[model samples]
Target: MNPIDTDPPPPTACFTYGSLMCEDIMAAVCGAHAAYRPATLQGHRRHAVVGVAYPGMVPNADHRVQGVLYLELPDSAWPRLDAFEGEEYERRIVTVETDGGAHAQAWTYVFRPRFAHRLAPADWDFDHFLRVGKARFMADYVGFDTLQPR
Candidate 1:
């Protein structure tokens, strides 16, 4: 007879490009703090979603998205993250390069193609997000209040 292994598998890294890139927002959504590293995803573009403060990521062969790579997020956090992303985004596995030039596999939320029309023509500016949009996003975004426990 053999004993069963019931422990959950190790957590994987998550690549966050928009509001989740903010440590404060990540902590609020995850219900705990996570370690992260500066990373960039190739062949993707980040654009401001229509009438929204946060940005959305889409595939673009010529572009790249700079974001944070959150390390080893617990399994419990995915439901909250998926719910927060809503119907417009889908989580997918992607390769990212850290600032230290190391490559890693990470799960990233991508803006659905059907919602492409909602993306503004211009690129989403992270600096502007940090400077101006963070406050409004934190205050008025309803997703935070509606996360259901898994």
Candidate 2:
């Protein structure tokens, strides 16, 4: 008889650079907590979205974005995450390098091409966000209460 194969499929991974990098916000939106690590994505830039507390990422060959890589999120999380990202972003797969220098593929929300004009000229600062923006973002972002899974 042939040997039985019984390995579970790997979970989907995500790379987040903005407010979603905060575990509190991520759990509140996705309804699950995930293990995460520091990572960097090449050929991209993270910029402050004008008049908002969060940032939006776009492709920029000259830049690299530092973020967090979340692992093993339950399948149920994607729809809520998608709803939270709204029409302004489109989720796509990209490769990221972990702090340990290992490369992995993960999904990331990228700002849509039409909204590229909304990005500020300066890069978004994650430390600044933790210091001044997290509270405001958690309280005011309308998407939290209205996530309709598609």
Q: Report the CA-based lDDT of candidate 2 relative to the real structure.
A: 0.90
Candidate 2 TM-score, true structure as reference: 0.89
Candidate 2 local lDDT, 1-150, one digit each (tens) = 334666534439999999999888888788889999999999999999999989999999999999999998899899999989989999998999999999988999999999989999989998999999887887797468457786
In terms of lDDT, the poorest run of 10 residues in model 2 is 1-10
For model 2, name the residue pairs that clash.
Answer: none
lDDT, candidates in the order shown: 0.89, 0.90
Listed in order, each prediction's TM-score against the native is 0.89, 0.89
**Clashing pairs for predicted structure model 1, backbone only:** none
**Model 1: per-residue Cα lDDT over 70-113, one tens digit each:** 99888878888888888999999899999999999889999999
**Which RMSD values do the candidates have, in order?**
3.7, 3.6
Off by over 4 Å in 2: 1-11, 142-146
lDDT of 1 at 20: 91
